[model samples]
Target: MTQKKPTSRRQFLGQTAAIASASLVPFGALSSRVSAQSPNERPRFALIGVGGNGTRTAPVGQQFADLVALCDVDAKHLAHGNGLLCDGKADLYGDYREVLAQDDIDIVQISAPDHWHTKILIEAMLAGKDAYCEKPLTLTIDEGKLIRKVQKQTGRVVQVGTQQRSSMNFFNKALAVIADGRLGKLYKITVGIDAGGWSPEISVADVPEGLDWDRWLGPTPVMPFRYLQDPKKDTDRNYTNGHTHFRWWYEHSGGKLTDWGAHHIDIAMLGIAAAGQNNDPVSVGGSSRHDVEFKDGVPMQDNRYNTAREFDLIVDFADRDVQINIRHDVDNGILFEGERGRIFVNRGKLVGKPIEDVATKPLPKDAIAKVYRDMPIMGNDRDAHWANFTHSIKHRTLPISDVHSHMKMLNVCHLAGISCRLDRTIHWDQTTEQITGDELAASMMSRPYREGYEIEM
Candidate 1:
């Protein structure tokens, strides 16, 4: 990977402003923050692995971004994101390290799977560029702490793609209601994600062309390409495509635990104010029940994903408790049970006691401004999230969904998944962010990185 000297703030913002004004692209209502460059100037960024979510979301990024480069291990994703660049001059690369190596890039939007997140983020910070990495911040607890350390030491702005923090209806409302005691001491939080407890037995097969299979397996142990081929070899669809069912595999994702759990449990933890404090949870407990056996069904116990297909994780948070559960169903949502009454919130729905409770106080006007972070739109708009990132870049301000807060939220997701994986009660020293008793459970916090791919502090 080639490393370019860091670009001066003036030059970076100058390039950003030129692209923003000349593009004249339609912006989401969130775009109201689009033009607010600090007196200093705007920030430019690059997109890493612009596939799936990144591909769909990067266009809206234009409202607040000067897309300078696009990168991916797969040429397809790299070319795709570059095509969305307003300047039509954005450079392209197949390896994200190359994008991070460039000193001119102010930010890197990481939309890779859970396993790839930590490596890309650590490298980007070391390269001096701020980062906008996506959710389930890391694959393990140790990696989360290491990334947190780098963020603090580097002083680089990091906005995890946990967009719920910026959502007015979910995060803002939940935070306010809890703080105001509307939830009346907030007894417990129950977060559930639906999934069918099903997985086909793994089988061997050939690797496809164009993909550097080894690169795709970065930081993860190497395996025969057949280890992940489609269970039903009759089908023409190869399961290892960049966008294949990655969420189901442990090497690429944490299944539902990190998938919806990252989103739902994050909101749940935020409402309870248990995020980021290592001394938070004194004990953790859980169970994971899979419908099939590892040798016959999934090949490797934790390869294509050893994450729980169904499980209940409980965390003791001093004054309160949190129950995180995953099941195979589509009716997903979050429920908060307090002394007063219970509140249920999910995408497109918010219902609770008195029905009027949410509207009654409506986040005091002052709180509204502060909680919404003064963004024009108060929801998870890709454009809005990107707008906040770009705005912060020039203003030298931290975005509301910053790495610290996101990492705090991510800790819960990682903890929940860890609890399920261990399937036993365990003690956690939140302040130290370490497991107290079980060495086996503690060992899973981080995994061995492939050669030349280790993420260092």
Candidate 2:
């Protein structure tokens, strides 16, 4: 894992520019045919995991592409999604591999569970399709590295679902302010990923007819069907409970650490780098309080939610000039504290004197544009994120949420989760990109895949 010194921003940008230039040649050759094609000749899309987030993000892709197919493990979700997309116009499948095998699909929108993300995404890229994957892109640190390697070999466009990167008032503005040094000599950043309390008891129930229970458990260990009764509907038989509660399990997700932390931590890392601080943290130490008892990081209770309920984590950057504290004391948002001023931001609002002062004293005209890698701002945040993905597909360039930077940011999230699980301080060797001197902590970097579901480079 040993590597050379990190590339400077200037060098990185220069390399990106060269790639962009080469990308144009492929599209340029097709420009004549592109002009002849109708405006409706949009890229064809196939969506996998058409549940909660998938349903919400499908329209964004529809705004720029045509939905040609839908795949889901649950028949109820598949039916609902197909109904939303022009009745039965799009093809339907229960297996994602079938959708990937279609040559007509130019893009794959992945909104599956966190555990299934890495396998599906790697397979999609290998299938020669550009992809737009939802956030917390990898389930583990090893998955992140595998993704980077595959993406490098394929040279395909992949955009992660961290939409805040394109937000106008929140992350974009926060980065602009930091880049301008309005928050001078940034010292500490506090991130709060509030708790959602413990979920009610889940009991074993009859597996619904249309659901592929085995396929749904893809890479995770096999277990009996568990369902939570819907309080509102005592008679409903669709069995929609298991889909909603997977987030609280360690096997399926990193809980709030990777759930909300995915959004806030990505922005926090951007702000840290913008303020001339190191993006990679050299060490992480933390303690977390889980709602369920645990032995060797596995929850003792098998039928209830097990992810951490509350946590207080501290991370020291490579330069030691900036420290990040992740906790549950405040509302879910990021608070950047600096020598000159401080500002806090979340989805609802971006506040504090520093942010407010931007009105009387505006940031540089190119600030937001620069944060977006000089790409022109198009519509709203979601639209802009989608626009970057589709535009990159046509132009053959990298999107804003490209694999390289996303992997680096997700690494921090994994480290925080590991530290919390082990209840000890962990040191990271940036050069080698491995945990230093801690065998048990390092071993958690990856997990064993269920025999048939292994991911190969």
TM-scores for every candidate against the unseen true structure: 0.81, 0.89
lDDT, candidate 2, 1-457, per-residue tens: 1112344545534544444344433322422222234667877889999988998998988999888889899888888898886376678878787776666777899999889999889877766678999988988898898888767766677899999988977788888899999999789999988973476667888888888888888898887888766677768533222585677787888888899888888888899988988878798887888777776666788877778788889988886888889897787899999989999998888888988898899889999888889976877688889988877776767788888898888888889888877778889987788999999889989998888777633
lDDT of 1 at 45: 75
Expressed as tens digits, the lDDT of each residue in 1-457 for candidate 1 is 2234455545544543443344333222122222344645545778887678887666666555577777777766665556555444677766676665555567788887667999888777666677788887888787877776766655566777767666665556656666666776566677778762344544555655656778878888776564454556776555432354666766667778788877887777776762222225567666666543443223344323344677766767755434444343435877877777777788777787723665654656655445556655523646567667765654556687777666666666666666665567777777787877888777767778888777643
Model 1 residue runs over 4 Å out of place are 1-42, 84-89, 226-242, 274-279, 291-305, 321-330, 358-363, 370-380
Best by lDDT: 2
The model with the greatest TM-score is 2
- In model 2, which residue pairs have backbone atoms overlapping below 3 Å? none
Whole-model Cα lDDT of every candidate shown, in order? 0.64, 0.81
**CA deviation > 4 Å runs, candidate 2:** 1-40, 230-241
